[model samples]
Target: MAAPAAAISAPGVLADLLPASTRARAVARDAVLVLGGAAAVGASAQVAITVPQISPVPFVLTTFTVLLLGAAYGPLRAGLTLALYLVAGMAGVPWFTEGASGFGFPSFGYIIGFLVAGVAVGWLAGRGGDRTVLKTAGLMVLGNVIMYAFGTPYLAYATGVGAAQAVEWGITPYLIGDAIKLVFAALLLPGAWWAVNKFRSQD
Candidate 1:
């Protein structure tokens, strides 16, 4: 017989609520999630707008997608998903922003930041950081900060600009968009958890 939901350890994320029936099935499910998550990020990357006068780094939807996936998938799956995205994109997959690939781009550091922020967000979500509006908001903010931390410096190095200039080009232009994304994520994650709980109660 399957273990009762209450008998299982606390779930790291919503995905963990659907426990696998067997060890092999669990592995298969995780593999699928990783691949699916990576594809989602890649697809979202295509939704980009570049203002050359403002920054070489195109504003993209991948940040919102990555953070949500991380909160939903938890640490291991999120990490693997982002790692796969990075490796595949570097190996000639035209999945990076605006169908670009093979690294060395001015925006490549933000891609790297996605991997790290995904893992960080997933780790926090595993500890119940995504279950409330305030906590989820903070988590999203931290994830954005992580992305900017890595991306700004690399933008500087890649374009031979000073730190202040990099911030002006790579980050300042996108602050409003980032804020909007963060607000949506803050609402969505906790709302999903509430839905999951309601479903489980009905079951």
Candidate 2:
């Protein structure tokens, strides 16, 4: 029954968020992407101005979107969706807050990080938690780790710093916000299930 529901309702609204095709889904995917982008921008509220002496990357809150998409959309869509996100930013969308654009420095690794971490989230949705909040939270944490791995080096090279300093440069400032987002993402899975259970109980 559960699998049937996932399959039956997969089109139109839920699964429709991403088009599996190369062309037709492009417009739909772009429109759907705006929501995720807005959410991502929302999560990272204050743009940490890049101090050239420190680093050239401005801080933003896309991680929340990263986790959200991974859990809500699953691996393939989530991964591709976020990948498109980075691509858009690279193409000069101001999506990154540099007040400038293009794929260069600090962002490269973090982009890769998003992919690495998101993979865990999407994979965990199946293996770790099953659309439950707690497991989702755990998976997100696992995925967030990949962000650190990718972000560390850019911090070091561009800022003329070391590993610890690199961590300080980017990852540390956002730690508090990231924690809160993690909790929010964790609850999303359980909350979703609760809603499903409520409707099911009506039967």
Candidate 2, 1-203: lDDT as tens digits? 35544444422222343445677667567557655654464345245456656445555666776766666655666666667666766787665544444656655667667766765676667453636666666777777788877877865775677777777777776677778888887786668667765674554
Find the 10 residues in a row with the least total lDDT in model 2.
8-17
Q: What are the lDDT scores of the predictions, listed in order?
A: 0.92, 0.63
Work out the TM-score per prediction: 0.95, 0.70
User: Candidate 1 at residue 53, lDDT?
Assistant: 84
Worst 10 residues of 1 by lDDT: 1-10
Candidate 1 per-residue C-alpha lDDT over 106-178 given as tens digits, one digit per residue, 9 for 90 to 100? 9999999999999999999999999999999999999999999999999999999998899999889989999
